[model samples]
Target chain A: MYRSKPWRIFQLSGFGSPEEEGERIRFLLEHGETGFIMEHDRNTGDHLYNVDHPEVMARREDVGLTGATIQSVRDYETVLKGIPIESTYGHPGGGVVQHGPYALACYWTVARRRGIDLGKLPGTGQSDFFLTYLGCVTKQQVPTQTGLRFNADIIEFCAEHMPHWVPVSIAGYNGADTGLNAYQELGAVFANAVEYLDEIQRRGNISIVDAAKGVGGVSFRVGMDLFEDVAKLRAGRKMWAELLAKRYNINDDKAQRLRIHSLTAGSMMMYPQPLNNLVRGTIMALAGVLGGTQSLGVSGYDEALSIPSEHAHQMSLRIQQILQNETNLCAVADPMGGSYFIETLTAQVEEKAWEFFDEIEAHGGFLNTLDSGWLHQVAHKNQFEEQASIDDGSKIIVGLNAFADDVTPFDIDGFKSSSSEWKHALERLNRVKSERSAKLAAEKMRDLEAACRTDTNIMPAMMEAMDAEVTMGEIGDVFRNVFGDWQTPISV
Target chain B: MSALGKKILLAKTGLDGHWRGVSLVEKRLQEAGFLVVMIGMATPDEIVSAAVEQDVDLVGLNVGGHIEVVHKTVDQLNERMVGVPVFAGGAIAPWAKKELEDRHIEVYPPGSSLEDIVDAAFRLCRINVKASTLKIEAQINPKYSADGAKP
Candidate 1:
């Protein structure tokens, strides 16, 4: 008797002050979301800068628009207030490579302070290469090599400490959204997996089984191409299993099992027909479920206009709930399995993905392709082609290009978060700096710097820094002074 | 001045580094025979200074932030480079779009066609030929070379 676990409705939730982010997470959870993702302010979080950083200060208005401005453990505590971290499966920001340690350490430190066992904490860390190096390249980040080291260290740390925690999740959603086609997304994702697993194997600290398991929980973007995306996901799992068994020589079924988190494409949410996105989200999400995704996050209807409003977030969760309850989707395992058309498409996607994987290998490796801008070029080519197709009318978006009529009922002035986000975040940063033990914070920062310089796992020092109440900018300064900026390959 | 040699200064007026929108616009403008100068993620000061220094015929702002940032950039451009047309594209909400449009800034939100953007560029720059039709002419004519088209 096979019992299917209903796919977890994990929504990416954050914005404004820490308290506001907490409130949004709580709202989603109340609305039947199984897991919550903490989104840090892209200005501060993605670049690891504080609100006061000059680059951030230039566009201070954009600070909390994308996510919450979390600078210290106090902010983390504020965001996690009343949220049960012990039971909840959380994704604590750090989608960028350099920010991963700080995000994980802050979340882990929060759990520790709450008397929650670190080993028992169930959550995931996202130091996604595609996000950091490829998709949304930050102004300042450590080089790809350093990022690889950070991921490997994270893997080892999670293996030693938090067994239930997914140390690093490779997100192909970033790549696909940036422009990689379905097969390219699959290939690059597996190539990314190899970078982590191989680095862990070379380090020889943790077993290959643990490393494989750590890297297996990956995410992909399920777009409007329903059957194609479904095929891509199926191919992803098969390729993962084959890579693990053949190359790594690992036979542990638990390690070989690929867990997928499918996110609906935010890029596909057209601004003209904003309400139509709910339908798009449904179709994309259905593709995810059919592809056997373990978890799913539906993009909001207002995604193209702004960050999701409260109603938009609710609608996203309700879409998943209806699919889970009304559709009886969980009654059968691999609902699209055994179909001749689906099977052939899956095989073709797999074949193409391996070819792309080999191409990555030919270009040195995944890290090198990022370092050399090869992957960015590939994504850019597809991005331009896709845009061209849309431009020439070869591709027709419903209300955007064809059937250009607005019959929608309401006017959505995209959810504007608290305009005072920067002010509040600055005030908190000053408070934390003034109140925290200066000597202790400095000591911990030095240790973090040293950890970055040496082969030591940076997580311990990062945890101490979080405990000592170090700010994001201070850590960013240390990284800049130590690792230097990754000469961004693409001009984006 | 011919459309072929018109210099367009493109700058992202936010710290957000997602460059697909700007890059696509840049590609279209370049292919339309405009000299596209990209100052990636610049402040108002940097944008104005670059626009003046590059002697760009038109200024394109990739507005990914609050309308205030774009307003600031436009204000600076107006003060520094008089009569230079400004247009933008990105996640400009409806209200922001209206505000920019009110200030004579053409706002192309997501789903706006590249051909339309190129056409707007030509019209704003006061070029006689339509950009969509000028591509083949610019390509075939030896006198329409990027450097030769320069004033």
Candidate 2:
């Protein structure tokens, strides 16, 4: 199985203007990265606000720091310039629920314009509930029920239209980084997958087997506890297979195997001794490999300080390359198999994971937990306890709670994206507002609003809106009017 | 003086919502007998107005964006409430930390222990640590005797 293919080197990268984000993608692709991820500015993209919106205007300086500002199809075109979308494996950033349809529609629209078949496109878009509702809860989001509908629509849309596209990826990495322990992460990830699968099953638009295949491509986070993480991944695959077989009665081999994309824990990166994180990255990457991940993204060494600089991004790629080339670790499948310690640990993790999964089920599934803040409370408790461990010296995070001393050496100031990104994005937003056929944009927005109010899938109208060059904020207005805002359970 | 009346205001200074640090800091301060009020995500003007209205002894910012924004908030606080101390913690780079320190703002970047954060809070709010510890013990075990006697 390991020899079937080498794990893809996928890095989360984007910042500044469209041209700048495109340049960074090209750089990563040139530096042995197998795939590129497009990260849109969270301030606008997560909230679906245009740069001209009042909220964005208040904190204008933070506009381009997180990712690029892609307000419309025009911005998407500029970012995808000369990138050969048909041949590349990309993650067009829609890590939030409400932005998923727009992000995917823009990319698919760009591909259709380029004469690429929709069925042949290879990419993934994450409308992760973990990221949206639990980990990095945005300022405004559609209710959990609405978010569920959006995800279900994407699953069915991909099942029919784009066979190669991963409609939505449920990333446990975000949840784990937030505070979920290993077992809780595993349990929550499966509980989340069950929500999608059950929703797709309820709709009866697509076969449950196909929907399971779509949800099988998930990601997890690996931290400093190398052995536990390796065991967690192993148990995760087993649980996925067992859950599908026992719950959904899917005996298909293709549907049974889970494809994992592992990212090293970003929270583990130290702020004081940033260089020490390189070793941490290497070790976490090794755990992913041992756990048999299908793809991997190493968190930059300077993750705690800021987004990855070009050197740090390059260093991330090098760590993956060194493992793939120099280590010869890919020669054997299940390298940790048959070891008594690993076997026992994997079983124990799986057992504990099932208990947590059952606990969530008893409390009313995953979405209800998020809506009721039960999951957040659990994570909150763990967060406090984790800090307690560090405070009591039970946990020694070398440079953080233990070492307590560091020499003044090299300084890593972190990456600074273009300061004028917000201004440029605002200018583009205005140009689209004026340049686009207003009549058609309004009609498309009405259709999207109508779709949001009905049981019909919103992607078709959303795609039409993107074609009409509808602004992100306009779409957000429709959502706000139709679905209103999600009452966040926990106050930030 | 007792720590009961000390009020601490915590607010996130950016649009980004990563509340792991903020939540922990709030809980720690509460355990140490400080009343903590969280104004989820606030602008400089909002933070300043809230600080004034709440009459907080100290203002803690969970910085997740540009240092310029934090500076703006500090400037507003300094202008509005002359002596209310302010501190911050988040994804602060060394340079940003230095910049904040230059303005006499204590920064607790990532890797900072909770003990240090609580210590900073007591120091910033000018509450005696010994008094706060005694108050916490009294609250936790109400019937306990002070001179090593069992309840």
TM-scores of the models, in the order given: 0.96, 0.96
Report the interface RMSD that candidate 1 achieves against the true structure, in angstroms: 6.8
Give the poorly placed runs of model 2, Cα more than 4 Å off: B1-3, B130-151
lDDT of 2 by residue, A1-492 (tens): 667689999999989888889999999999999988898888889999999888888778888888899999999999999888888899998989998988999999899888999999999989999999999988899999999999999888998999899889999998999889999999999999999999889889999999998899899999989999999999999999999999999999998999899999998898867889999999999999999998999999989988899999999999999999998899998799898999999999999999999989987899988887778777877887787777778988887877768885767887766557889899989999999999999999999999999999999888899999998889889999999999887775
Candidate 1 per-residue lDDT, tens place, A1-492, comes to: 014478889999999899999999999998899999998888788888899988888888887888899999999999999999999999998999999999999999999999999999999999999988888887788888989998999999998999999999999999999999999999999999998888888989989999998999999999999999999998998999999999999989999899899999999999987889999999999999989899999999998888899999999999999998888777887778899999999999999999999999988899888877777777776887888788778999999888888977879878777667888889999999999999999999999999989999988899999999998889989988998889776664
Proportion of native contacts kept per candidate:
0.46, 0.56
Q: Which stretches of candidate 1 lie above 4 Å from their native place?
A: A1-3, B1-3, B134-151
Clashing pairs in model 2?
A: none
Residues B1-151 of candidate 1 have per-residue lDDT tens digits of: 3347799999988777678788778877887878888878888899999999989999999877777888888898899889999999998888789888999999999878888999998888787766556542212222122222211
